[model samples]
Target: MAVHHPATIVPTKLELLQAWVPHQPWLGGADVSTVTRLGSYRFDDPDGEVGMETHLLSTDDGRVLQVPLTYRGAPRVGAEGSLITTMTHTTLGNRWIYDGCHDPVYVTALVRAILTGGRHADLYAATDGGLVLEPATTHVRGSGSWSSADVPALTAPVVSHHGTTTTIHAGVRLTLPRVLVATTPAADASLSGTWPGQETPVVLATVDGSS
Candidate 1:
């Protein structure tokens, strides 16, 4: 069964956003005055420790942006495959939570859900054999890359002061916490350097899982 995490105690989506939004890089800042749910998706982890939620947010304009996060109570042992590294310190100590989605099993399940038309995607599995997530409110689809159980590609780029253009190369140091570069033919990697104030993808994508 899918498990629910502490976040479920949140009485409203806004409350949850208020608590979790500032911690994420894509959420803009602690001063965010407004947030409207554009669209969202959930995934069930077979192991059940980490809850994954994919949310799309935007300003008053219709331009939508995506934020995929893995909510974990704690971190894993020697979590080398993690993408975004972040931790919150509670009164007890540090509540270890990073993007563990690169774990092969985690990636596999995400791929499966995308391929199958499952009715519910609310599920999470931790590396320590713990599971949590609300099991009844979500489903998932669209599996394209299942054979290559490789780590998600990582690109290093720094957003311009205006947050439009990004400089990229092989070893450039990046200031962002995590950038999910989608690998495929369906991903629109068509970036624009000539234009300012344009929407550059924080999550670079592939169209057909091609490199």
Candidate 2:
């Protein structure tokens, strides 16, 4: 389960994206001001220390983009280049945001999910009354069915980016399509998602164990 706080955050997620997204080379020079939030999905961190979420945003040109992010209370060692920004959370205090593709915690969770048929984490909101179950706006599922597959421990994964996709090699190879599309590609195992306006599931990540 993923718990969310009702408290406000300085430099809201959208604001940060507005200042950062446009500069990404994969978008083909798209503008952030015209971007709109489509939906988001979450993967639970077993240790519960890091927050993993993937946001789906739509561009004015009808292109949907995928941005996976991880939130940490402190800086992640050796991830200075991947740091998105630092912001204050009213309830959680200081937070260091990093692109999930470069975070080990996220890579572990993602690989596990894809290899074990994992689904999106349940969402809960912390309120004055208590923890309340909140409906998730986006849904995701992994295609793998190897429930007993041993997930290899990954450390300091080698990451690369090109065009509209990013690839990570850490025992298991993962292909993350930054730009969302409608068709699902062939892969050993994969992750796909669906949102409100986009009910048709679209492939988000693909896994190849050949590595």
Candidate 3:
């Protein structure tokens, strides 16, 4: 529930990790770019328009990045995964925190609210966490998908050792797990948890790498 009103702006999550620590790939080289807070939560979105956040960053080498810092008073357009910036104010007016999950309408409303067990923010307790608390369960979409999980065709069904048993071709027979992706007029379906009496998830082709 931070994000006061836009008196001014700039990256505030430690200046966006000093401009995102040389583009982060787990970051390397010994230097001094510390960001130690370790705990934070909250994301309320009723009428107060809250999104207050904090996670912490810059552990270097070992890499534990969650590095969040939100304070929305505006910007819930299309959220997804999160990470936005525009906040910075000091003359005592405060307000301007952008980056609300890159805004794909708040990442499909936090991926349809984690597939239905929604409750965003699990940075683990530390004063029970902070920021303002939002995803207290709203259906955070969960067929285990941040976009259908790790994308090598949504992970699962593999049996390789020259046996050549890499799965997800899903032409369909029947099982307990289904994630079909071979389209023409919408054939394959069933992502478990009752989401597939058919709702349109029939994308055909492309699993060249494996999720």
With candidate 1 superimposed using the best TM-score fit, by how many Å does residue 204's alpha carbon deviate from the native?
Answer: 12
Ranking by lDDT: 2, 1, 3
Of candidate 2, the 10-residue stretch with the lowest lDDT total is 25-34
Q: How many clashing residue pairs, candidate 3?
A: 43
lDDT of 2 by residue, 62-122 (tens): 8889988899999988789999999899999999999899898898888888888899999
Candidate 3 lands at a TM-score of 0.24
The prediction achieving the highest lDDT against the true structure is 2
The segments of candidate 1 whose C-alpha lies over 4 angstroms from its true place after superposition are 5-33, 77-97, 100-106, 115-139, 143-211
**Residue 47 in model 2: lDDT:** 88
lDDT, model 1 = 0.39
Ranking by TM-score: 2, 1, 3
TM-score (all chains, Cα) for each model: 0.43, 0.95, 0.24
Q: Worst lDDT window (10 residues) for model 1? A: 187-196
Q: Model 1: per-residue lDDT, tens digit, 49-162?
A: 666665545444334444455656566666644445444423223344434233433344443433332223545543345664433322233424333334244332212221
